[model samples]
Target: MSIFERMKQGATEAARKVEQTVEISKLKSQISTREKEIDRLYARTGKAVYDAYSRGDLSRSETEVMDYCEQLSDLHEDIKLIQEKITNIKLEKSCSACGKIVPVNARFCPDCGKKFPEDDEKPQESTVGEIRVLCAVCGTENDIGARYCVECGNELSPAAGDRSKPNDPAGDSIV
Candidate 1:
């Protein structure tokens, strides 16, 4: 090929690459936006379900509740994929003791208590536990696992040591 033809071909190839890169960036931005939208939709759906349940309305006419349940399975799969992507994208920060992934500047790992660089903090997973507690003073609902109310800041009833149980013949203790 002539020198001029080679130059033209190189320019065209570079332009195509630039276009491709732009397209990829656009797609990434769109994905991020859609992810936010999905999150908002999930929150709204959860609220609707809660509201309907409070009203004792279990009818299937609620689109938000139905959509949420329908999306739950797909969302779970998407969550795993997102986690994998995050694990891949984040900078590697290994714990010196256990050789596990740690924050870039972690002061101490609850797992090993080994000081690691704690740079970025990711949201932790939520686990399910059943416990019921009613605040004594404010009569506010408190988490069974919580030591204090998040709203009223009232100290929760400490786990009784059966002191209250021994006094009564009935097995019921102060909860």
Candidate 2:
């Protein structure tokens, strides 16, 4: 056989091998996708079974299913505790009206416009050197120089002392 013919045959063989490799890779990718889809379906089925068990439609005789459900319940409680810790650390709370996160000191829900009940205890005054101006309307403390209350947007008294009442210009006013 001529050298040119042998070279042509070898090139054709190499091209076929490349095509086979590409086909195999594509098939593997498709298999992986199908496997993921199967996993999702399995999760949905498991959730449905768990829900049924929770609703008392399933019997307690199924100890395996009950154990898994108990584990999930414990995990959910743990998550709730972790979330509460996060909120406390951030000085935030969920608004009862909208379930949206708001500052712990907020007097109203920004999203739902729901007024929060005043706490029995007064808000603690700022530490030494940090002058806070208290709002007469909402009693929310603001920075010394702030013209408006941060929580209620009420006009603040220029004086930080005796914030319960606005400063009277006339000295004749009774204490």
Candidate 3:
């Protein structure tokens, strides 16, 4: 190729790289804004739930709580996708256990003792609409799909439905 053609090609490649960088930056900013919104939604939902409980009106808050939870879940998934894009752009990897950024070639996370999954292994997708179950016996939170409490080894079935109220029938609130 001639010198002038080589110069033009180089300039075109540099312009494309700058354009790609700006797009990634925009995505990052959007993720940050979405995260802040999620935080605000969480606080608002918590207050709504609290206000309902204080008034002995748990049923009234259920719909709003569900909506907030769904929104938060969607935001989390979007953040994950954005992070994946950033990772691809930077050629980085994330620790599955702690979600910390790490080198793509690293075998384990430096911040957490999480081993990277092998190339042939695939991670499991999380179950959608998983409602967290608070253990009535020990006040420990467990997965919605968990059969037993991880903290106190208590059965989760009986305590699952009692999330909005006290476990004791005679009590008005959770102690």
The candidate scoring highest on lDDT is 3
Collision count for each candidate, in order: 9, 0, 0
lDDT, residue 123, model 1: 40
Tell me how far the alpha carbon of residue 155 in candidate 1 is from the true structure, in angstroms, after superposition: 68
What is candidate 3's lDDT per residue for 6-105, written digit by digit as tens?
8997798678679879989999998999999999999989998999999999999999999999999999999989978887765567767777664464
Off by over 4 Å in 3: 1-10, 95-175
Give the range of the ten consecutive residues with the poorest summed lDDT in model 3.
120-129
The most accurate candidate by TM-score is 3
Model 2 agreement with the true structure over 58-155: per-residue lDDT tens digits: 55435655565565565556556655655554456777766866557666554455666777122532333566666788877565555545476565
Q: Which 10-residue span in candidate 1 carries the lowest summed lDDT?
A: 159-168
lDDT of 1 by residue, 72-108 (tens): 6565567556544444344234556765564333344
Cα-based TM-score, every candidate = 0.34, 0.39, 0.49
Kindly provide the TM-score of model 3 when superposed on the true structure, using C-alpha atoms: 0.49
Q: Which prediction has more favorable lDDT, 1 or 2? A: 2
What is candidate 2's CA lDDT for residue 46? 81
